[model samples]
Target: MNPDDFSRVRSLWTHCGLPSRPNGRDSEQHIRRELSDNTASFLVAVDPDETLIGTVFATHDGRKGWINRLAVDPRWRRRGVAQALVAVAEAELRRNGIEIIGCLIEDGNDASEQLFVTLGYSRHDDIHYFTKRDRPDI
Candidate 1:
């Protein structure tokens, strides 16, 4: 997805129950900046009607590939939309020479955790995620 896709992408995110922190990284400016990253891929899945039904953001920190912001319209869930998005994102990351790919699924999001597990991702309960954010919204 490019900067031109901001509106549609944001709309799809909202429809998929994803957060839209306009004041933070979800804004068009930040999105454009992310798109500029050489290792980043913002992918969107569209239907025959040209409507975006899913999205996934993939990037690597010169080592491990990270998948984030995966979302699929509620109406499209359980139909393989998320799975396809993830597959394509993984392929893009691999194309960039990333060897280890991973994702962070929030606690209590059983569906997402299960999906990742079913896709051959192992859960590491031993690792704890820590983040230092300048602002909570970001």
Candidate 2:
């Protein structure tokens, strides 16, 4: 999406009652670089007037592809924008020779969980999501 679409994306998230973390330093340039490079890709859904209604980000880590921070504008929900984004990301990953795409969805987020399943993703058992920060010593 174009730089002008950030306002729409921001508004969409706000309308969804979610506070997005700031893009963290030189956001526009970073996004442009990502879209131009092999490292990352993002998709956005825009209305007839080019106002954004949804967005998702994907990254290639030299081994597998990962999708994260997917969101759809609440006002524009259930219109297939999110689905399209996922499709595009998967296609790109496949093109890059990525054998599989993995997404980490919070356990209670039914919609996301279902979307991945519907898209042919299966959740692997025996692997639970755990986090560890840089700090050590309890």
Candidate 3:
């Protein structure tokens, strides 16, 4: 995504129920940084009127490809926008030599789970995910 698309993308994120963190990751700086790192992995889909309808962000750390922030406008859900975004991102990752691609879907989010499953992503029940906030203790 380009700098010009930041505000629309941010608004879309909010509309799709994705939280915005205090860190720079949720800022324009972060979007610029990620796009600079890998432009092809950051994509946005728009309709004929040029309104942002969908978005997906993917990145690779030279070992594994990670997909995140897959959001589709509520008015456009179940219309193949999310699937198309994933398909393009996965293809880009594979073309860049990434062997493993993974996405994290929150528990109870059955729609996302089904989308991934329908796209052939196998659930790895053998592994658990842990996280640490980058910010310091209050």
RMSD, one per candidate, in order:
1.2, 3.9, 2.2
Q: Which pairs, if any, clash in model 2?
A: none
What TM-scores do the predictions have? 0.93, 0.78, 0.91
Q: Write the per-residue lDDT of candidate 3 for residues 19-137, one digit (tens) a residue.
A: 55535466667667777775347889999999999889888888999888899999999899999999999988998999899998888899999999999999988889986766642
Residue 98 shift from truth in candidate 2, angstroms: 1.1
lDDT leader: 1
The deviation in Å at residue 40 for candidate 2 is: 0.3
Candidate 1: Cα lDDT at 111: 94
Instruction: Residues 34-129, candidate 1: write the lDDT tens digits.
Output: 899888999999988988888999989989999889998887889998999999999999999998999998789999999999999999999999
Sorted by TM-score (best first), the order is 1, 3, 2
Q: Residue 9 of candidate 1: its Cα lDDT?
A: 92
Lowest summed lDDT window (length 10), candidate 3 = 19-28
Which of the numbered candidates is closest to the native, going by highest TM-score?
Answer: 1
Clashes of each: 0, 0, 0
For candidate 3, the lDDT comes to 0.85
Between candidates 1 and 2, the one scoring higher on lDDT is: 1
Tens digits of per-residue lDDT for model 2, 46-73? 7898777777777888799998667887
lDDT of each: 0.89, 0.74, 0.85
The residue-level lDDT of candidate 2 at 116 comes to 85
